[model samples]
Target chain A: MEISYRDMITVLHGMGFGVLFMLAFSGAIGVIYATTVVGPQWPRSQWDNAMFRFYLISMAALAWLATISGAYIIYPWYRAVPPAGTTDLSAYPRALLLSSPRTAGWHDIGMEWKEHIAWFTPIAMTMVAYVFIKYGPRLALHRQMRNAVLGFTAVAFFSTAVAGLFGAFLNKYAPVRGGPDIVLMQEK
Target chain B: MSAEHQPIGLPTGPGAAAILAAGIGSLALGVFSFAGDAVPAINRAFIFWQPSGALSGVTITAIVIWLVSWFGLSRRWAGRDVALGTVNVAAFVMLVVALLLTFPPFMDLLQEI
Candidate 1:
């Protein structure tokens, strides 16, 4: 089961879209939770609180996975060059074939920030979720913790949006070479 | 005011400040250690690993600081006085700084100036 770079990009693109959709859905749910449950001092059932916790955990996991996988696939510079003895170049796209470092374009810079900032998302989200679980029940019950959780979630949402934007730019401006166009052997 | 509504325990005050300082300091070390040609010896030592190693070092330091601070300070503090506000604000600032350091324009500017 060999997969070409083009196929990888296609699969990744689909996965990215799915992650974006999930983020949006989760963000909406978060807003609802903040406004209706947290704001109104509504008596939340155990199941309701559990569902919110689950949503937070899911969003964190999805954001972590998406950011890591996206960075790995989108940044060709991070990859190691093939061994000197091997001549196969068909597996990689031209954009990834650079022998020298290229000047950092705006998109590249955006990705740099995105990649580093994304490292905090999982930790921040997990902390918020942990606080919710430890405290238990209505957000109104724990005002300070609720504010902190809301702040962290807001940052998480921002980071996810930025990552999606960077991915879109990379896909549009730095596309992978098609399978048919890849040369099986490179000239030394 | 109920037991169930009490804040979760976390490091606070000096403990949290220490952890935050260590984390940010490690991150700064990582960024500056890899930037430019100022330290040829350090670069040569990390020739195979370079910036990745430096970055990982920062993360590792942060984790250690967090764990140590949690154990050392979390038990000492009462729930409501946890000072989570301070920790959260510091963490947020550190996150922003980390991002800014990695931003392309910042990196370019640092190189030029």
Candidate 2:
């Protein structure tokens, strides 16, 4: 079996990094809630607190990886303009989506929104991680700080959800396909 | 913090700075994106890298803004507990506004005016 390089990278960008980051939100949110809401009732040791901080840091790292890969590596290919008078627009995903009125909205709305909104996830997540790391279990003491951290994490979750959903739909309609073919298992 | 490093109960100032800077960075992204969409000249100008188009510049600029604001605010309020109520509300408001601004429909709606 053979797969195009672009398809593999695109999958890595979306399913690999993006989806992993999205999945992490549930765990991160649960731990954040526990840190702020229930941790005050039961004190955690430095080890436990450090573990929670590490989790947040890992989530933030995933978010950064997802965003950077999408924007720098995948996005350039996705938005590559078709040469003049190009009849077959298969190589250009953006033009392909825009060539037909039926699919034009995918580029105009879905992609436009996805590219921009996706960024908030990393920024918000970084802040959440930093705040949690800074305060750790003591977050419960400062209620305002605790709430803001929770709120930002929630925003990161919401941002990634929107971006990931749109990304799935966009790929379904106009997949980013190109680059050298990579061979998997072959007859030997 | 790493396992070797201890996480103390830092003052709210540091946390607030991070939160506010995130909000500002998000808002900057929304603004730059909308501006690039609405103005052809601005769009062309934002093409810092040819391959990535305006997106390269937009994101980089926003990140620079985020880091700078974070550094400035952190230095300004480190150790001291700043007024968090105002910072919290302002940050949330900025986040909400950034969300609205990034929405395509909202951008179109505002552009129509």
Candidate 3:
């Protein structure tokens, strides 16, 4: 079945939200692991190793998905212009556009920073996964790798927070249309 | 605690501190090179990529440095000594200098004088 632009937006939005939620949950677990379990004095069980691997892999996958979905939602704003001629601009959310004076504020600076930092997430997380897989079973070496993983997760968390802030601002000012038009837009 | 009771991971000494410092330092340097107003050359120099791409390039470069230092130094020396040694000290100093140079007040002062 054909989907409308608005429907596509909604789908992308839902996917983005899901990814962000997963990132936050995994990131919290990562933070706990970094603080409590990464060092020499922490208990080392097979379960600990398993959990660490699970968390790192999940985080990396979720982050990469988030990056792609976020790009779809945000990149259009970089070149957003009002619909031309008789074409209806009402279907588009004005707040998504950086060009919109209504939505422009200091938050734009934060958004700009967020965009750049977001690029780092997938790369860093992938590296963490590589280091872990390549140097597993070496407890001392794993601890060092854990430190790097923690750093990468921290960056991911910060970027997600900034994206959420921007999302909230857009929702407040320029809520998108719901239902059939969304379906129709996506089909076109 | 006995040998078995002692954890087999990284120590909570200089080694861990060094790793943390290097990571944070690299992040700060990335931010400074991209977001700070002081580095206009970075923006103009990259012809192939957009300004944002250039910023990412700089940030990635810093991350590479941090990763290399963390792995190379840690492998060469014991964790605690690596943390306390000249390499960690150098990383920390580099972070400090990057912060100072990119700080808005510092950039403003430089522009004025």
What's the ranking of the predictions by DockQ, best on top?
2, 1, 3
lDDT of 2 by residue, B53-83 (tens): 9988899999999999999999998887777
lDDT values, one for every candidate:
0.50, 0.86, 0.49
All candidates in order of lDDT, best leading: 2, 1, 3
Best-fitting candidate, measured by TM-score? 2
Q: Candidate 1 lDDT, tens digit per residue, A1-188? A: 35556646645643554365345556534553564365534425767667766766676666556644544444443433455666654333232434325623533465455555555555555555555555545445545556656665666566566666665555454444445343546667
Off by over 4 Å in 3: A1-48, A68-73, A80-102, A119-156, A171-188, B1-25, B28-41, B50-81, B84-113
Model 2 CAPRI rating: medium
Which pairs clash in model 1?
none
Chain A vs native chain A, TM-score per candidate = 0.65, 0.94, 0.63
- Residue A34 alpha-carbon offset, candidate 3, angstroms: 9.1
Candidate 2 residue-wise lDDT at A21: 83
**Per-model root-mean-square deviation over C-alphas:** 7.3, 4.3, 7.2
Estimate candidate 2's RMSD in Å.
Answer: 4.3
What ranking of all candidate models by TM-score puts the best one first? 2, 1, 3
Residue pairs clashing, model 2? none
Q: In model 3, how well does chain A match by TM-score?
A: 0.63
